[model samples]
Target: ALYYYADNPQRPYDPEKAKQMLSAAGVSNLTLKYLIRAGDEVDEQTAVLVQQQLAQAGITANLQKVDPSQEWDMTIAGDYDISVNYWTNDILDPDQKTTFVLGHDSNNNYMTNYKNDAVKDLVAKARLELDPKKREQMYIDLQKMAKDDVNWIDLYYSPYINVARKNIDNFHQNPLGRFFLEDTVKN
Candidate 1:
């Protein structure tokens, strides 16, 4: 799990501030269509919570449960104002998360459609950077930039758990949710 960085900005939940911002922007009775994948209990529950939160901010969110098969296409095509989804990187590298999800030229970007030249340059530099310190700094900068840009609101990270019997030897669980039983043995 990624821990919080010291320099990361804090955005406290303030429904009043959200209301004021909407009023300043001349937006009233604003309603957003929130797309959720059907059969996902977590997504449905999150949508309900988000709807209540948005209502407190004077904004309306209409939740629409969509089939799993069509969820990807709908989100990629920008058919919904907001979509509920989760992403888990296969490896513990910032490359896939940063470039594929936030980069402008990437085709895997859901509906964010966020485009920034600075972000693009930073992602490219971080990928090829040979210096560890430089790469880390670049990623830090990218995180701050992405947060400021409000690319997406991160709710929380779910933990993965693995259970096994006592006799199972060499049974290890991968943090990335992969299982390799080739070396595992039951004594």
Candidate 2:
């Protein structure tokens, strides 16, 4: 809902306002098709929550749960109206997080089909920038533009989990979610 409305974090959620907006737009009893990938409890539960929220505004969300493999293809092909899926920006660099997913020519840009010259330029410049401050500002602006554009819904944040035995030594995982197995020694 926040993503769809480009909501500001400072403002609280107002279902009545949303209902009024829908009513004003003559959107009562509107039905929208929603997609959810199979096999993930988080994704499934989130979709249901979204459905319930939209109902408050007199919108009916019909959810279709499909195989995880088919979900991407359907999104890329623009066959879905709305889809609840998970993505990981595992890399430490924001460039990897944004560019690979939101770049104009990005392979993973199927959901929004987003192509913004400013965003592309900022991402490009940020990649080559050596100054941390400059790079950080560029990424900040890029994210702000993306949110304003309502590219996608920002759902719950899930932490990455990895387990190892006590005997294991030098076990480390990069921010990119890569496991350093070569340096790991087991007693």
* TM-scores for every candidate against the unseen true structure: 0.91, 0.79
C-alpha RMSD between model 2 and the true structure: 4.6
Q: Write one digit per residue (lDDT tens) for candidate 1, span 1-187.
A: 3322477777888999999999999999999999999999989999999899989998899998889878888888888898877888898888878888777765645468887789888888888998878888888888898889988887888888778899998876688888888999999
**TM-score of decoy 2:** 0.79
Total clashes in model 1, counting residue pairs 3 or more apart in sequence or in different chains: 0
Listed per candidate, the RMSD to the true structure in angstroms reads 1.9, 4.6
Candidate 1 TM-score versus the reference: 0.91
Candidate 2 per-residue lDDT, tens place, 1-187, comes to 1012233343245679988888788777788888898887888888999889878767789999999888878888778777876666554556665776567764656466777778888778878988867766777777788777767766766666888889999988775567888888989
True-vs-predicted CA distance for residue 105, candidate 2, Å: 1.7
Show model 1 residue runs off by greater than 4 Å: 1-4
Quantify all predictions' global Cα lDDT against the true fold. 0.83, 0.74
Q: How many residue pairs clash in each candidate?
A: 0, 0
Highest TM-score model number: 1
Q: Model 1 — which ten-residue stretch has the worst lDDT?
A: 1-10
